[model samples]
Target: MNEADVFTMLRDTILAVLIASGPVLALALIVGLVIAFFQALTQIQEMTLTFVPKIVAIFLGIVASLPFIYATLTGLSDRVFDLIGRGGP
Candidate 1:
């Protein structure tokens, strides 16, 4: 593959990775923010308080988003395989 083709492939792979990771990352951010707010209001300075709830919330978020995540990954895999099959470059 030429440099241009390699660059394009890398770009596409990065985009796919970002899109796949977006939901989990967003969930983590939202959960963290909410936990922070709760800790601030209640003055609960327990580290476990923040960590446990965030972990649970992130786990639940992952469970709920599993289907979408699976689909996205599978789609990306298929696309990559197709490109390879077609002798991309």
Candidate 2:
């Protein structure tokens, strides 16, 4: 493929990754921020406190968002396959 095709593929790949990860990453960010706020308010500087909640929240978020993530990835994969099948530029 030429530079344009390579760039387009790269862009699509990055966008797919971002879409797939967006929900979990957003949940982690929100959970971490809330935990930080709680820690600051109570002065409980426990490392495990932050880790556990963030992990749990992110896990749940991933589980909850699995269908959406899967659909996005499937669409991207289909698009990539279509490009390849058509003898990508």
Candidate 3:
């Protein structure tokens, strides 16, 4: 691939990654903020309290989001493969 083609491919890959990960990442951020707020208010300050909820929230987010993520990744892969099949330079 030429420089421009390479750049476009890289950009597309990064966009796919961000789109696929966005939900879980946003959930993790929100969970962390909530946990921080709770710790500040109740002074629980438990390590597991901080970690467990974030982990669970992220897992749930991932589970809920799997279909969309899979579809997005599959679409990207299909496009990449199509380009290759078309004799991409």
Q: Which candidate comes out best when scored by lDDT?
A: 2
Residue range 10-73, candidate 1, lDDT tens digits = 7887887788778888988988998899989999899998788788878888898888878878
**Candidate 2 residue pairs in clash (backbone atoms < 3 Å):** none
Q: What's the lDDT for candidate 3? A: 0.92
Per-residue lDDT of candidate 2, residues 1-89 (tens digit): 69999899889999999989999999999999999999999999999999999999998999999999999999989999998999985
Q: What TM-score would every model get versus the actual structure?
A: 0.87, 0.94, 0.95
User: lDDT of all predictions, in order shown?
Assistant: 0.84, 0.94, 0.92
Q: Which residue runs does candidate 1 get wrong by more than 4 Å?
A: none
Report the alpha-carbon TM-score of model 1 versus the true structure: 0.87
Q: Candidate 1, 53: how far from true, in Å? A: 0.9
Q: After best superposition, candidate 3 residue 7: deviation in angstroms? A: 0.7
2 or 3, which is superior by lDDT?
Answer: 2
- In model 3, what lDDT does residue 80 have? 94
Off by over 4 Å in 3: none
Worst 10 residues of 2 by lDDT: 80-89
Top of the candidates by TM-score: 3
| Candidates sorted by TM-score, best first | 3, 2, 1
